[model samples]
Target: MEKKERKRIVLSSNTAFSLYNFRLHLMRTLKEKGYEVITVSPEDGKYSELLKKEFSFFPVKSLDRKGKNPIKDLKLFFEYFLLFRRLKPDIVINFTIKPNIYGSISAGLLGIPSISVITGLGYVFIREIWLTKFVKLLYWLAFRFNRAVVFLNSEDLNTLRNFSKEKSFLIESEGIDIKHFDLTLCKEAKKDEFAFLFVGRLLTDKGICELIKAFESLKKEKPKVKLIIVGSPDEGNPNSVSKGELEKWVKEGLIEWHGFQEDVRPFYCMANCVVLPSYREGIPRVLLEAMAMEKPIITTDAPGCRNVCVDGVNGFLVKPKDVESLYFAMKRMVELGDEKLREFGKAGRRLAEEKYSVEKIVGEYINLIEAVLSKS
Candidate 1:
């Protein structure tokens, strides 16, 4: 009889928060199954202490989530290579932009298996720019030796399929923790306010600007309606709105702005409906969280967004970037009556339990890892 050695898995992204919030369950599940899960990302003073408490956290200097600095990116790529040369992880899973591109290149250089998870085709894919061409070329190069390529939505899968050596897979979300978003958190007394909650980064491409416009319009029609904004302004992103603008919105009493909340349950509870008017998504985590909490949702009919919101079923689907469409959806929500909204909430919760539970998501990831390993 012998004890088999546990495989070491390295999970990487540009930001520690992305790994902390999205991949914890996957890490925990793999760890429980006797895999050593290590997190590699740039150090953050706010989250470094918390990250260190759980697993092996390796801080790399290469990640700049907002801007594209080629020298910094090259340095980050070398950082990954050097770290891999030292740590020698059995497998690597890279997320977000920089890590997926450069991390995969690092893994390929080391002759180690890697998986690239396309979380979202963000600002670059939103427009047909020279940068978009460069990004696609980089993606084509990085995934040369990847074990598997994963996409959160089909649109992105189709967009980048030709780049991957192997067939790409879709694991929309790793699934949400249903219990963490219990329906009991909904605040019934707040119904008179008819609050709408918008979560995620405060990037203009996330439809934050359009959301504000629609919210302003809705407010003129129904003064009691509330728009509660969660998440912080990412100054690093070119699409981010100015702090002065956010301050104006808050001071003028347009939105109840709560910046970058680690715990968003309170916001979900305080809302009658959740909204995300993003240009696109790779399946929105916030909308899934809202659904799990039995909060109705209103989102764009774009890739990742459409995956969660069912038009007129669990929530309404408006066209992306169309302020009037979003305005119409909001107005309709106010007129949907309380009982109908509640029904939407209930349907959303059921969808979360049946389709996007953490258990299901973790299992898929586990299976994907095991399947890849078995082939080797």
Candidate 2:
């Protein structure tokens, strides 16, 4: 009898933080099932250290996350090409815009099967500037060479349908660890003042300004309400909020900014409600975490965000970027009282178990991987 060798899988993303936070479960499962998992991304501060501790981590120095330098992009493409050629992975799975584009192209050039996960359309599509057309063109080229495309929401699939003729699948999200984020884990006593937690990058597209405005208005009527923001400014993103502006809000006692937390479970445990007024997302992980922790939510009725909540069931949905609509939703949540809010949280937990559990999502990925590999 001959010994069988495990297939090698390369997972590339924009940042190591994304790979660790979003795809850790999938990577761990793949390793447990006897596959070599390699992670490729830019070294993202402490997150790179975290990823390095778990699996083989490759730092792509040429990948300028938000830069438009063609020379740097070309270098990144070559870096992926050489890396894939040397490692000779059975397959490559890419996330985020740049990784999807450059990584898929490089993997295709090496005749390795690749899957691009469109985590979210994000800024390029939201702003629709000159770079938007360029990115779309690159996406069309990369996706054409890809074996499959995965979307977190249907809207993103529909939006990019014309870009790729390949088979596309919607996975909802990366999926939350229902057990790890169990409601029972949240043992912290609720504070005297009602606290609303917002977790994500402090970017303009995240509706940070609008959230602040709405909270400012809500605070006048209900002095007991508190807004806690948990995220760091993305310096690479043009839409990122200025530190000065954030400090001004904090100085004014409008928000409690706790930047970049490795563990957000405590914040979730303390929060009365979770809010993410994002303009759009592939699917907000924060919402999933909140749901797993059995916390009520309020989010924009935008693409990815809408998929998480059924209006008036688990939480309230407000119009995207509409300050007044957001304010009203927050006001409604406050008025719902503790009992109704608890009911909402319980409903959210049910939804998380049914739809967004890590077990179910990992099964989907395993199935997809098997099918893709068999055909290849």
Candidate 3:
């Protein structure tokens, strides 16, 4: 009698879209290769259909952004433990904060093989030392048991290395689908008024406030310059910008806020440049998408953002949270006019093709997963 192949895989993450989009590709790809993929996330309407159609969905009560309660966190821990025991997955892949910490812990308890991807070290690690220390300890303990720890940026990989003796691997930003973000489809940008686009959760840590302040200041001198802000407030995130504050910016006519849109390519297409002033990132997907679209960029010189923009080449790099620096960079892009900006955009597209394409990144994930399975 032939022994049945045992290859049950589990993927856990807090962000619905992160699981649905980037990780979904992996799930489908793996399933096609004959592995059963189970997805765990905060059950939401957005993912219900896909879960029903494609994979086994496990609803886990997670701290959704702002609703952080210690009691609730405890509940989540138990929930994770229960799920792990029930699934008895041969391999587990965890992403984001809560999952990476609690999920890894649960997997360890069950003696399950696990892999964790450090997408970004969020607010907890970026703030005061006490909290940072606490979160670092969680990472140290949880990550120690994983088969592989994947980082999106070199700096993050180095940081993880500093904290522990574990060998960590690096991947280009959460892989962008090059075919989906083709530059050939982009309309020629306007020559007179240069458009600067900001996309991401409307969070303070993402530098939304700073970007708004800088845009307001620049508009005084360059009235013809336009600013477009995409993405909705992440109510769960502690650092999310208040709806009232964003409304005030719109009321003041400082910039155009498009709320949330399912498709971002049109916004990217119409813009001359992409800008992100985030305090930190684990390699922002927006920058990768913009570059894939052949758009010039302006972002802070912080670790992850720096990975995409080569100062003065593909785009300008400014100091994070420095309104004046961001404003000056915006002004300089305007001064460079359309031709120079197009050249920069062309360079950016080439860089994306060479370094950050989806094929390249997905290949890395495939290699990592195969290597882990080989050992198992």
Candidate 4:
């Protein structure tokens, strides 16, 4: 009997970090199942090395997430088309805007099976009406030919449904790694200082400004509270806060900005609670990671954000874009004292294991892929 041909899967993302962090489990799981995985993204010196060591890397110039440039976008579209034609992949799995929209169209044109993962609506869908309509129309047309379209959150799924009135596969945001992020064995600090952690690109839409304001208010009342912010300015994202602005906040002693760190476990270890006041999310990884680390969370009531927090249960959920609400949540956590906070953290860990574990998420993707392929 002949051996089955290995399914060649081409994974496309906008950023190297996204491929490295969010899709790591998916890559490993597919490879372990004997699928040939080829990765494409805008090359970074660090990510290029990691990709070469882990999987096949096909470097391509991706559109900057920050500013709009028609010429660059066109070039990127053609570049993806050329690459897709050259690779002749069995399936194309795309994440982020450029890969999902343009890459899906390219794959569709060539009659190849494809999957598009919508991570978040972001500013593209929320801010610009004309662009949103145009993009929605494109998705309605392009997505019709794809084998599957994966959304990180139910809101995104509903949004897609609203646009196309077509059914699509909905998975909770790429799930967390419960084992990898387990906080049971984490070293506890002897000091009594309470720290709060915030992670993600420094974007205004992420509610970083609101977080800063809340932190300032919290600090005035509780001088012992510490705020540590991770992640750097997302140059590709239009709503990202400028480096200068972040620095200004840091100089004012509002919070400690850690810029971009490869490993965030240390921050998690030092933190008593994790907070994300974003306007919206597609199931935030930081909140999941923090939960896995056995840390309580404070987040907004927005679609993806609320899914992670169960109000007074695992964590507190405040209204999005509300600085006073955020401040009060932080204050309440502070008043809960260490023992109550610890209990909340434990509850969060339990939730992560039950709901957001990477193993569970990987299995969902594997099952979906196999199911889709078998149908073909």
Candidate 5:
């Protein structure tokens, strides 16, 4: 018997943190199946070091997270073009905007099969600025040459359907590691006050302001309730909330801003409910993690968000950017009592097990990759 030669697969994202955290399970699964897996992203110090320990890692230094400058973008394009030309992987899968656009185009030019995973339409789509039209144009151009276009939710798929309807694939987020985020590993800490947790980059589009306003109004009524913010300001993003602003909020005794945490499990263990007033998402990873931890959630009834919480079943869905709606929802969660909250959490966990397991997601991806390869 002969050992089978391994086919190389490249997984590219905007940041090494995303590659390590969101796609770690998929990368491990690909390696287990005998494929040589390589990850590409802008170097994120610690996360870049972590990726090198488990798999091949490449840094795209020219890639900027939120920059729209043509010169820098062209440099990124060439960087990817050169990298793909050298590695010559069988297939490349890209996540986020720049990688999906520039990286996919590079692979396509080199005659290598490529797939673009639109993680979410971030700031570019959120605010309809000149950048939005430019990005949409770039998406149309890049998507034209890809082997497959992947979307996390149907709303995103429909938004760019003209460019990718024939080849678009939908997955329920990157998929969650239910076993890792297991509720049994960390029991909810008993506390006298009810706590609301909001995790993710601190950005205006995430509805951080609205959340603060709602929490402030709610605080006046129920002084014991707390809002724990567990994320850092994303410097690259245009909508990032300044550190000064966060500090002022903290000093004002509004929120317990803990900055970013490598391990969010402990924070999840301390909260009564998770809330994300995000305008949109490819399904927020934090909300999914909260569900796996058997914690009920409160999020906006927006695109990827609506798909996560089944309003009143697993959790509550409030209007996006509506402080009043958010406040009322938080109030309901407080009044709902422990028993009802537990029921919502249980329903959320069941949903995570049934639909969003990493194994199931990876299996679907493998199947798609094989099909694409066979046809090619």
Candidate 6:
């Protein structure tokens, strides 16, 4: 019997790392199941090169991740149309904003079906400026012909459902590899240092400002409390805290900054607890990874953030934007005995195994792709 030819699918993202970091496993799975997987993103020499070694890579013209330049976006629209025309992918899988909107719309024009994953609402919904209103309007229009718009949280799903005519699916998360994050604590943590770690892009919307303020306050009382921050400013994010500001924090003895790490397991193992008091999230991956590594988490009670944390069970949930609430949570962590910390860590690992493993997410992706493919 002759083997059936594989269908070609292109994955689109605003940045190359989005795919490299999160979706590489999904790409590999699709390839193993006899699908031709191609990645499309604006070039970053390193991640893009890494992507090529695993699967096909096609670098698109500038997507302008931050700027709202109309001409640039219009040029990008044409570029997507041109790329789709040439590649003739059977299906297009888009992540993040520009690809989710422009890629879907452009691919639709060529009669190719696409799936757009809503990672998060982004600063658009948080700021709620006229620009965001206009962007939501664009999302409404662009998603018109899509197969389905996938949301990791119900809040985002419900928010977009009011404006969109197409079907909405809640997949919950992009997932974390539990085994990869499994840490065998190689070193003993200093008893004097009650290390609190925050891992994510340093953005105002990510609650970096509140975390810093809370840490500074907590440090005044608990002199040994160390704040370890591990991430760089996302220049593409409008809400980003500048490098100078981070340096200032370091100088003030408020934070210990380690710019960015390809592997975050060592950081997770080093900390007593992990924290992310974000304004909102798509089930924050940092929290999941921390859970996998058996570390207690402290995050805001915001939409996606709340899903990972069961207050008084796995970790504490504080009020978003309230520095006082976050400060108190940090205080509580410090006051808790080692046995209580151990209990929180164990429960967190249980949650990670149940909800945030690669195998579980692969199953979800398989189901999603089958459902979409079955439609036609």
- Against the reference, the lDDT scores of all candidates come to 0.89, 0.92, 0.84, 0.85, 0.92, 0.89
Error (Å) of candidate 6 at residue 287 is: 0.8
- What's each prediction's TM-score? 0.97, 0.97, 0.95, 0.95, 0.98, 0.97
lDDT of 4 by residue, 1-376 (tens): 9988898888989878789888999999899889999999988888877977989999987556544677887787789889999998888889987788788888888888888888887876656678888778878876876778888888888888754344388888798878778776568567566788899888898888898999899999889988998989977566779989988988988778888898888888888899999888888999999999989999999979898898888789998889999999999998997788889988898888888888888899888877766776
lDDT of 4: 0.85
Model 3 spans > 4 angstroms off:
1-3, 66-68, 162-164, 188-192
Model 3 TM: 0.95
User: Where does candidate 4 clash, by residue pair?
Assistant: 65-236, 65-237, 66-236, 176-358
lDDT of 6 by residue, 1-376 (tens): 9988788989999888889999988888999988999999999999999999999999987698988899999999999999999999888989998998999999889999889999998778876789888998889887886888889999989889975545788887888887688867546666678889899899999999999999989888989889999999998667899999999999998999999888888888789999999999887989998998989999999989999999999999999999999999999999998999999999999998988788888788878876787775
How well is each residue in 131-175 modelled by candidate 5, as lDDT tens digits? 789889999999988999989999999999999879999987888
Per-residue C-alpha lDDT of model 3 across residues 131-246, encoded as one tens digit per residue: 67777888888887788888988888887786445558887676788889987876665457778999988989998888888988889998887889999998766788988998
lDDT of 1 by residue, 1-376 (tens): 8988779999998888788888889988888988888899989876766778888999998678876788988998899999988988889999998899999999989988889999999989998999999999999998886889999888999999888735599997868999889978654564678899999889888999999999999999899899999988887778888889999999989999989888999888888899999998888999999999988899999989999988998999999999999999999998999889889999999999999999998898899988887775
Q: RMSDs, each prediction?
A: 1.4, 1.3, 1.7, 1.7, 1.3, 1.4
- For model 1 the local lDDT of residue 327 reads 99
CA shift of 243, model 4, Å: 2.4
Model 5 stretches astray by more than 4 angstroms = 1-4
Lowest summed lDDT over 10 consecutive residues: which window, candidate 5? 182-191
Candidate 2 vs candidate 6: the lDDT winner is: 2
